[model samples]
Target: MRYYYAEHQAAYRRLGREGMTQWNDLFGESWTFDDFPNRVFLESVLDRLPASGEVLEYGCGTGPAACFLAARGFRVDAIDLIPEAITLARRFAQERGVTVNFSVQDVCAMPVGSKQYDVILDSYCLQSIVTDPDRAAVLAAVRDRLKPNGHYVLSTAMYDSDRVYEDDFRYDATTGICYERSTEPADDAVQLDNTWYLPHRRHLRPKALRAELEANGLQVLSQQGELRGDVICTPTRRG
Candidate 1:
């Protein structure tokens, strides 16, 4: 089974430099934690952040989100698994004169040296950890990195039912490894266009996710369905 780290590395390579440029073009300004303009998911999360506090954004991509938070006067730390991504994010922050601590480190293996953050933002990254086994360790690591009363906000796709693909799917929740069979069609089948290249699909149901959080000592502050999108979970550390 492919580990989460390996899967992410492949994705990073796929994005390469061109993908980063595309992201900058699409977002215009640096991305923020709760960035979507009219989405209730981000709006609710933004409402929870302190005006100025220590913030950590996991999977910060090209650093747009970290830059945005820094511009707002919050101390920000952003991390991504891709070295090139972190380099681009650092350059972006430097050009914008926004001070953000950017690093290339796996969130599960972060060497943060016992530091805890006031808010941890996981904007669509957790869904990438599709394996059930890896989820526990990742959640535990996140919990350990948060301070008392710290907030965690995350958005991820949810699946209503089980599915099987023409290809292979493998996931391990213990290590958070998620693997998928290639979407390529077999011989004798009609040549499928790459229009629908679904990379991975392991979704956490809202009820199940809430139960997981509570079991891990996180208190759900508010959870809302996001405009026909995935459910957003905003939870606070138990004091």
Candidate 2:
């Protein structure tokens, strides 16, 4: 399967869960793609955000946090590889009466532009990357796009001591990806090094995650929450 094709399917099609379009049930029984807890995750890092400046958010599925930041007076540029997701995000921004720069671009190949941002937002998107190379590339892009004093607000799944892997899904400790390896393989099972498995999520252990970030020239300033939490980062000067 191609990268982000599964997510593209998740955009317009129903996963047969809460409702439609990857949103959660906020009220009673409904799914609004424009509204989700991911925005609340963004809000958790409010104290880290700059007063006013440009912010970059990668893998912004429907641009919930992007729209929220724009509404809060920050110039936002949100990107996701899925074109359909970006289309939906643009529509959602219009509905919210907020202006956000939403584009269909892969964060792994993020451009090195002259413009640097005040903040780079992860918002649980980092764990979805699911591979060492891709994660490294994306983190490098985040550091490159951030200003000297900019913050990298990251939220991702961490494999703590208590986290458990389900029976059906197989967890690759080395890669941190949980694969859907059922009796009947999924139609869209992705092949990595000739192994067919549909990656559900990636959980980075705290120690390794910190090392990876530091290797990519980002130093964690503070962190909060539990298994899935927010981390504030700043660029580390390399001699």
Candidate 3:
């Protein structure tokens, strides 16, 4: 495996081991909060989708959005890198009596039929891939699996302002990746913070992100926010 892939896998394995003993509120009931902005953004974007669309939530940690969409009558498939997270998501779906196909899979190598989904959502997960090539592979996979004209919803951490990465985090100017790493391994609770588990992250400027997405066949339709960067785009060419 590549170094980045191995590093991410090991870190998440540690996270799974940690979650066995304690629950991080972020992936637990914290999703139940009514004002969760991601949920709000998702709910507001339903107008762009067809009725009862088939949806795929890539990197769907603990399946909140999957369950939410399933509850709203969409067919949902949610994939996450961590088995523990998938287990928790399945249990959460059962508790809510909502059906979501939760699978333990890596986004870079997704095992799904092409052109099967009407919508694909990546909620701040693409940056976790860290490297440009890996991110491109994921975008290609998403493009291949989306039906023509299907919407691709992306949420990412953007570093466009002077205040963005001024907080002592490490920034790689060559790659446009910004991150902070622990000298030693962080404990389970610490891993609950996405940065703790997947420490190597790519925080892109909006222009760069747009270029990458467009290069992968998506055309930007709408974009919002400098911090919680949300983009709504569609395939520029037939899938």
lDDT of 1 by residue, 77-128 (tens): 8888878778777877888899999888776555536888887877567766
TM-score for each model: 0.70, 0.81, 0.78
lDDT of 3 by residue, 1-239 (tens): 43345554554456566653212243454434223447777887998898889999988876777887898899998998777667777877898899999998888776556446899998777777776667878988888888887899888777655745544366766567765554445432123344443246787777888888898899899887746479998988753
lDDT of 1 at 220: 74
Misplaced by over 4 Å in model 2 are 1-3, 15-35, 160-168, 182-195
User: Can you write out model 2's per-residue Cα lDDT over 111-221, one digit (the tens) per residue?
Assistant: 777888999887668777766677888988888888999999887877766777776567878867787653445654666555566766778777777778889999988
Better of 2 and 3 by lDDT: 2
Local error of candidate 2 at residue 74 (angstroms): 0.3
Flag regions of model 3 displaced more than 4 Å: 1-37, 160-169, 179-199, 226-228
In the order shown, the candidates' Cα RMSDs to the true structure are 7.3, 4.1, 6.3
Candidate with best lDDT:
2
Show pairs that collide, candidate 2. none
Q: In candidate 1, residue 223 scores what lDDT?
A: 67
TM-score sort, best first: 2, 3, 1
